[model samples]
Target: MYENTVPFKIHSDYTPTGDQPQAIEGLIEGLNAGMRGQTLLGVTGSGKTFTMANIIEKTQRPTLVIAPNKTLAAQLAAEFKAFFPENAVEFFVSYYDYYQPEAYIASTDTYIEKDCDINDEIDRMRHSATSALLERRDVIVVASVSCIYGLGDPSDYKDLMINLRQGMICSRDAVIRKLIDLQYVRNDFEITRGAFRVKGDTLDIFPPSSEELLTRVTFFGDEIEKITEVHYISGKVMWNRNYAVIFPASHYATTKEKLDRALVTIEEELEERLAELREQGKLIEAYRLEQKTRYDLEMLSETGFVKGIENYSRHLTRRKPGEPPYTLMDFMPDDYLLMIDESHVTVPQIGAMYN
Candidate 1:
């Protein structure tokens, strides 16, 4: 496991003024006294954000700030990143730029499949947010309602991480296999995100955790020689590191063993569902469900993935029916602080996550 002991220190030029200091102190006191929640009300120009930062510093706990929308989340993320530049400040919102939900109209007998355009950078940052929660302390994730939605199982995601250290004994073939298991693609020609390449004895791993740095694992015969961080664009050796960790390329990462088990469970569920539909004399529905499921199963067996895989997350993550899906909140420690921006609006949005 990764370790981070740094306190939540703020680097703001302006100190708390007016009621800001009082509010910060009260919040910290409440937290220390085991209060469940406390509200901080402030008007415009009151510097509420700064007050929250101070509270976080005094409490010295990681925090998750939820906003009602993406724009507010982004703005808050930028501000917190500036305030705690030494810590891990991450942004996490929905990747979809524009999303139209899949729908069916029985009157018109129309089926409209969902369509979306994902912002790659946002998706990468989402991965970074979850990774930071698992690998580091002093983290602040400013997210939108998308965070309350289903996310990958935290246990499985953490288990998929690959830890490496300089001078460790490991074979090249074994390293490559581990990378593949972490969903890293092998691209010998071009270097990009979540890709690995071999140049002689050096294995350049383009980890998805960082957008700017690439991990260079140079092997001397059967033993590990060195580990260094390289700039992705300039190809300059930034610095040498004693240890390195590679997070999964995709958040929904799983081992082939789990995948095999999930496939069997999914197939059994499909049979049961189809039988229920047939008993209700819904032959067309049963046939449609079978067709879709079989096609997905075939894709999973052949390519290890299928579109809309999250729809089967219960089986994929080995959760029982009616069990609550894991969300980004699950990645954070239980004692982590939570701040809801514009709670009057954001609270309702969070409450409607399952509705």
Candidate 2:
């Protein structure tokens, strides 16, 4: 069906008796006009997601739903899942059962280091969400502000993904390189998520973001012989698969070349800002900036990461200041349709959602 002319099918037994009809009509009209952003000023219990689903069906475009909290995200995910049983409905949120972010109380001079335990279920859902988005076009991801947070760039993910076939020329070194690029560490001594170990011709991979499903790669003279999934805890083979792809381990898996280029730009900015500070006689701020940037650069050089790393995202992406950061939305194809549930809330949320 042509997307614009596709009918919005409301599956509910109860019809839009009151104001919902007007709200749905307006949203559909705006979407037909190719509006990039819109909102729905809906009240509580107003079937907001239902209306959004109807709009999505009308357009037949992939959609993303952002919720303010995890509970709301879960609710939205469940609802979308029910509404689109045949389509991909996903959830993306923080993969933490508990988290106390690293912080330092300057006034109290107390440091609160990082503390948290991973939530395996949420981690699985996140992996499922990304996999669904990449594999299918009819996906709807309900997420929290976490969607705006940092993650492995989708391009690296696409690159690192391992493509296997029944009979194809494959190199073990090449496969390992892709894994390492995806942030998996070569650990012959210990096996863990984001780490891989080799035994003769067999390889085992613990995908970073996956809670279950460890992949075992069997090689036949540099050609992929077989691929299987195993239980991470039991080390028991759960299923044998003919072919599959493992995504990158982290959200920031860029090449060293890109990192070096980004650093050069950062240095240029440092020089410019330092010159400005000197001209203004802001010696204190200048010294502070120099010390802070130097420390950050040192950290990046040693570990390829540093605290407050996102402050340098602009340099890495080569985007100008005030430009938008990449989000899940950027990963979607152009033919996808976006349906905003609450015009009053979703519109403002899109602009204000960024850090």
Candidate 3:
């Protein structure tokens, strides 16, 4: 059994009533006894979320509450945040407000390119969720089924983090280059998420995980001097820190070396697939595949990404065939608790996800 170093402190006005205390005790006991799957079996208005919160408090483990839809996920996140005001309560769902995936219809001889419109606020929340998991132990993430989708390797994300400390000797130009490599853009006029601006001796950054706060780093010549958090709108310094850690701007972050290796493997796979298609007398299929792959390869070589880039995630992550892609679950600590809300519906939905 893992020891709980961080205690779960639920800040609420009301205590557990009716069967809630009993239910909480039962759940906690089951969890302590290594019960893998146990249902709460509560009806409407049974204070299910309250009981779960109590259980979390008793268990003292980071928890993930998966809701069936975005609406429910938002509601759960709000409730959890209210319960654990001082702890980390984050919401995570698909950032895309609208997404039409790429499609190819052989019978109709038609192809449709992928299109998506991302919600900036939701993207920020997703980043906050991931960052909280990595930085804290008292975290509760309320999420939708999008949690099962592909995310960058947790190790790679940690490896790419930039740590800035006061008195550390570092060049300003080097810092800017590192941020650029992590997908942060330089915008002097507009301060926004994933963007940074540089003045004579100070660098202002709007980190992806933050919504209204900006990080100000003052450099003295080639050495770091100070780091401060400032209000973006009011331009008031909230606090000062000697050090800070900045994560990548995007979830798909990778190193240049990985990209180079992936490009080579992609080419080899394309050639091997083309040869098989030709041997099977599928000339038209082979020609179409060759043309599309070559175009994507050219785009990737030029820009480091192509349309439908996620299709090559396996190669980029260097995973073998049939290996499951890393998901949000991978970001959680090993002893974290996973609570599937409305399991009657959620269970089938999770099962159907693979199909």
Best by TM-score: 1
lDDT of each residue in 1-355, candidate 3, tens digit only? 1121356788888999988888888888898899998899888888899899988888779999999999999999999888888788999999998999977776666766789998999999999988878877888999998899998788778788898999999989999988977878899988899989999999998999998999999999999999999998798999899888889987777788887888899999999999999999877778778888899988777656676777888888899989999999999999999999999898788889956
For residues 49-84, what per-residue lDDT tens digits would candidate 2 score against the true structure? 777787787777777787767787888888887777
Query: Candidate 1, which segments miss by more than 4 Å at Cα?
Result: 102-114
Per-residue lDDT value at 211 in model 1? 81
TM-score of 1: 0.93
lDDT of 2 at 203: 82
Please list the C-alpha lDDT of all candidates, in the order they appear. Answer: 0.86, 0.72, 0.87
What TM-scores do the predictions have?
Answer: 0.93, 0.75, 0.92
Better of 2 and 3 by TM-score: 3
Ten-residue stretch with the least lDDT total in model 3: 1-10
lDDT of 3: 0.87
Where does candidate 2 have its weakest 10-residue lDDT segment?
1-10
Candidate 3: C-alpha RMSD to true structure equals 2.9
